[model samples]
Target chain A: MTPPSRFDEPWQAQLFALTVAMSEAGHFTWARWAEAFGATLKAMGTDRLLDGGADYYAAWLTTLEGLLDRSGHAPVDEAAATKAAWERAYLATPHGQPVQLPG
Target chain B: MRRPFGRCILDSGFGAPHDAPMPHDHPDHPHSLLPSDPALRVKALETILVRKGLVDPAAMDEILDTYERKVGPHLGAKVVARAWSDPAFRDRLLADATAAIAELGISGRQGEHVVAVENTPDTHNMVVCTLCSCYPWPLLGIPPAWYKSDAYRARAVREPRKVLAEFGVSLPDGQKVRVWDSTAEVRYLVVPMRPEGSEGLDEAALSDLVSRDSMIGTGLAGASK
Candidate 1:
């Protein structure tokens, strides 16, 4: 999803851009994420699983991607691309890196 | 980067550049032997401590247990303390972070080009490592377990407002939330603004206003009621 036009801040725009890219790349599917996370948690033990709850499942997708990269399933070039996009946005900011606005 | 345990001791403290033998037997010792995995290294050290009867194994374990939590916040507190005391330095930091941090003599292998991002009234910034966990080691010591976790990486970019809510930070409906993903080439740190009540406070008191979460952009600087 392209982030809402209301994202006035530079960092917000960058994050919106990144999320859109990753989602388009099929990395943000909730179904695939839930399945993989459920299996991993089953192996980690029940008590540990209980502690993790929903947040654990969310983190698992990121872990799955890393594991895919490590195992050569995901291309290293993709990561490089994401890094490049972030750098471009970061350099434009006054702080010289992308940062979040405080409430 | 691989050095014998003995050589690591000597080199870590005081040793001539050419005095120690080459870290690797080969002509080019490209990779250091130290395990990159923090848990494995801790385990290896724990075994040595146990064999030597240096306190009980449980005592060493306890140290490792607490050691992980203490290191990051301690380093963060120091950075915030320095920033609060020096406005010129803080300006320099906002301009060219790597050099500004080096001014405090806190640069090394892991913190080559550390950048500091400031959050202001108009903007909010958050950081993530979508690929691998790249962090500012000199200022923050090490990335936390949650930081390295995959869920945080994905959700942070996808639904940052939701994630921040988990940390008890919520932006207004119209406010924008920006997230930066760090890599080996470029690393980032959040420089939260000085709080309102901190006007007359000294460096130490001001530093108390900064928290690890604030530096991560997951929390706000301390606000006096």
Candidate 2:
């Protein structure tokens, strides 16, 4: 099906596509992804009920990060540092213009 | 958009009962990968994946940009416009969307089983996937985050009018609303009612006025945006 353009936002679509691309390339198996994601959902636990409207893609990312940690695959602190840089870029970038990571 | 995680999130951090313990070790604030903004967060993830060689940055840009800038509602718009101009094609679409769409040479994932619902003056249709984010990816590309959200999935069914209204799709009280929930196996595509004065326009021209949300029944086609 055409993914619907129904993604609540652009990030959701981007992330969804990213996961598919990574999986297709055999970087991670669907089973591995499901386990990690399922664990993350379980972590949300009883509180998942309280966080009434959590974004799935967000949870998916958390699962990916957590899985990477388990597998020892991330570029030591690269994910953390990239996130920080994005936060900084978002702050620096003006509204309506796309944010770019600076060199 | 943040409905608290009940007691899971303490006044301080995760699993902190009494004093809101903020561990601050890349603490997961929300929105999965944090960074708050979706675009920025996506960028961050993309950067890391590229560095790891799991994803080629150039190809990654192309894949994302294809859906973001290139592919979109326009493709669906053409299908819609052709249906408007040709009743036979519309009938084929309604009867066997896959075959009809295939007639136009459009085929891909997420649209393996497409069910086209036409919007008439008396009735309107909308699409959703309450179970999961099962969208007609081949026709619409990527779905919006709201389409995948828990709130939208619930509200789209329970209070469709309210949901449509929020989407700026206020319908007449007389028109009955039919909501279609897309599944992994079957996908629903809404063929919106064509606007008047669009009569003289060709299929391509008619396609120009079609927006992405219109196919999902959240917006109207041919209306000035």
Candidate 3:
């Protein structure tokens, strides 16, 4: 039988892919990623019960943000601003219209 | 119109040539942006990296395909089947799991170092990564949701018998349960004993009986019909 989807959603798999790709490209070692991920899991704590790995992926995103910040690749503020820009651009688009950022 | 380069204008530390300008910066045509959500955040990250030349979308697609399709438990089942049918291979697997697994052209990431613990009539083995969801992705695809759950990670080591019982695996009083804690450097794959009445089966047929849970030590191989 086919195994269940490894990731709950498409974004989770995308994040997983990006992280592994970047690491493989020599941006950072896999060990470093594992270490930060483990540390992130610890800081996330075990207070809440399982929520189908939402919390786990949240921690993964947080760890990626930190790694990017430390590597001087993409500062946290830059990523946040980019996300905000996308948020605004999409909001400005009309219903049934494609969203495009101002050039 | 997408700018070839020199859009973000930052010297990415990687020193690789930039792939393209940010997806949103140019907007030559009307492109739909996903609603502002968690997925959009990931898209935003991808956009930034693409602009910086740290990663490209094609590479991301390839990596995603590798994990999603090419790698998984069936590979591990093949190894388990070989170990069961060939005594010499079994000894080599127990003696040096990493090399033996690599012999089957399966070695990468979390599976770089593997230890194949044998489950005998006396001892049972289970694997857990208490730190996070560190799993042998190259062997057993992605871990099940429960493996990454807090309850399993916290309780598996402390109460293996109880957890096994919940999985419908009740052991005899004389059987010893051994829980192996997986780490980034090393992972454990349980080599469950071949089921009885499966002696005449070939490796290909025997592999059909190796469930993902059986390799993880949560369940046993199905009895041969």
Candidate 4:
């Protein structure tokens, strides 16, 4: 698939960036995710969360953020920053119109 | 808050039976003769909360308005677009939808194990979450208010063709209507066929042809004339 447009809407851009960042950091790998999530569930005693699977994935995303932070490739904060930038751009643009991608 | 109850009492005329035909028996009426109007009921509940100083009226209106506009169609269009543009991808979507959809970079909370079923000349497909509104969020986004209603869920599967007809979608008599029951484990999206005269359209144009109801299998994609 073609690279996601830089001008993608806030949610679209965030999704694109998260996918790319996680893939690059190897956090998207099922093995890594399963291990991290399993460990988190074990530590947190799964009972604390309402939906076991949802909670596991939420914990997995948290773990991924931390891992990306430690690796220094692209810090977790950078993800939030990117998302915020997109959100601001989206708010500024009119509704029902596609955001123009930068060349 | 008080108006609906007053109206209900006025309409009911203090339990006096009238000669006016019941709504359920009326051929033109789209909905059943249920005593309660869901929207009005919700408004009544919110009015109570507002009266008790729990939630502000403006806040409630804003929340409801945002939900009505933003959340559902955005995701539904994307799924329809993807299906129209990619046949190989569509095949995979029909085969093992959950994993296939995730490949397209759209899966998360309450969205896993999605299945896309096709409607053909001989068969038509519709979906309902019997227990609750378990929708394929990765594709169709949030389930609409009507989708979450017990009236819809209970009746949809039981009278598939009838429900579809009420939605203004009638399949040919020979066509077999297959109602897929959605559960917490697996949700379904209807992969409607590309409309006629839409053969040479680009992806964006094609996406425009897909409606939220079509993706949910309540209606078909409009044919280009």
Can you list each candidate's DockQ?
Answer: 0.02, 0.14, 0.32, 0.01
B12 in model 4: Cα distance from truth in Å?
34
Kindly report which residue stretches of model 4 are placed more than 4 angstroms away from their true locations once superposed. Answer: A1-103, B1-71, B223-225
Clashing pairs in 3: none
True contacts kept of each: 0.00, 0.21, 0.38, 0.00
TM-score per model (chain B): 0.66, 0.70, 0.82, 0.65
CAPRI band for model 1: incorrect
Residues A1-103 of candidate 3 have per-residue lDDT tens digits of 3444567776787788889888888898877888898888877775566543887888888899899988888887888888888767665654334444566
Q: In model 1 chain B, where is the ten-residue run with the lowest total lDDT?
A: B8-17
Instruction: Estimate, for each residue in B142-161, the C-alpha lDDT of model 2 and write its tens digit.
Output: 67667766667668899999
- Provide the lowest-lDDT 10-residue window in model 4 chain A: A7-16
Instruction: Give stretches of model 3 more than 4 Å off.
Output: A1-4, A93-103, B1-36, B223-225
Error of 2 at B92 (Å): 2.3
Q: Indicate whether candidate 2 or candidate 4 has the larger TM-score.
A: 2
Give lDDT per model, in order. 0.52, 0.67, 0.78, 0.54
What 10-residue stretch in candidate 2 chain B is worst by lDDT?
B1-10
Candidate no. 2 TM-score: 0.60
Estimate, for each residue in B115-189, the C-alpha lDDT of model 3 and write its tens digit: 899999999999998888778888888888889888898889999999999998999999999999988888889
List A-chain TM-scores for all predictions.
0.33, 0.73, 0.84, 0.53
What is the iRMS for every candidate structure? 22.1, 13.3, 9.3, 21.2
* Minimal lDDT window, size 10, model 3 chain A: A93-102
Model 1, span B1-225: residue lDDT tens: 221222221122111213344433432423233222222222233223233443253332232223233335556656666777787887888888888777766663422477888887777889887654556655665455577566676689999999999988877777788899876657788877677767878777777788877888888878321
The residue pairs that clash in candidate 4, if any, are none
